[model samples]
Target: MKMRIVPIGDQATLGDHRHYPGARLLLVCSLCGWDKAYRAERVIDRLRELKSGGHATRLEQVARRVAWNCPGCGRVKWRCHFAWPPGFDDREAKRLANLYRN
Candidate 1:
């Protein structure tokens, strides 16, 4: 199955994955050019383990709450987004990409 990248809105929470099935978290660091995609379920479980409110945590809040610091530069800059199952949409992807440009 093809996967499509989804723009994570400011109001999005970890639990929101239920509304968009097969979605994953995409974390990007602009400063160091570091990026990683994580499975949403795994992230939720990890958050629960850390006692950080798990699914209730908003995507925007994740950077502050999680250790998303760039490994290369050790900076705490991140652009959070989502990846979902479906065919890719170039237009939507481009728009989402632009939203994180600094």
Candidate 2:
């Protein structure tokens, strides 16, 4: 399923995806087929820096200029997505058992 990542405000106001437990920030580089999932909280930290002293909270704007330093294939540009589906990963399994439950 396609996930939606909506960044609504600054780190202090919007907080991190950690509040969602299993949520992760997925970075995919079409150029090299690089697909990696990083803790959303940590990814937000880096994104805060990439904000480049701007007050804008639009993630797409900030991410447009961000680049990932791919150790396997040197520096590469990547697109970001948020994922918090059920069965995300071992690290988040226990906490996200009720991910989609009503």
Judging by TM-score against the true structure, name the best candidate. 1
- Residue-level lDDT for 57 in candidate 2: 36
Q: Residue 34 deviation, candidate 1, in Å?
A: 2.1
Q: Could you tell me the lDDT of residue 15 within candidate 2?
A: 39
TM-scores, in order shown?
Answer: 0.67, 0.46
In candidate 1, position 54 carries an lDDT of: 86
| Per-prediction CA RMSD (Å) | 9.1, 7.1
TM-score of candidate 2 on Cα atoms, chains taken together: 0.46
Give RMSD (Å) of candidate 2 vs. truth.
7.1
Model 2 over residues 1-102: C-alpha lDDT tens digits?
A: 444344434342213343455656666664675666766556556657766533223434434656557665676666655555543565664546556342
What number of backbone clashes does candidate 2 have, counting pairs of residues 3 or more apart or in separate chains? 0
Return the TM-score for candidate 1, rounded to 2 decimals.
0.67
Give every collision pair in model 1: none
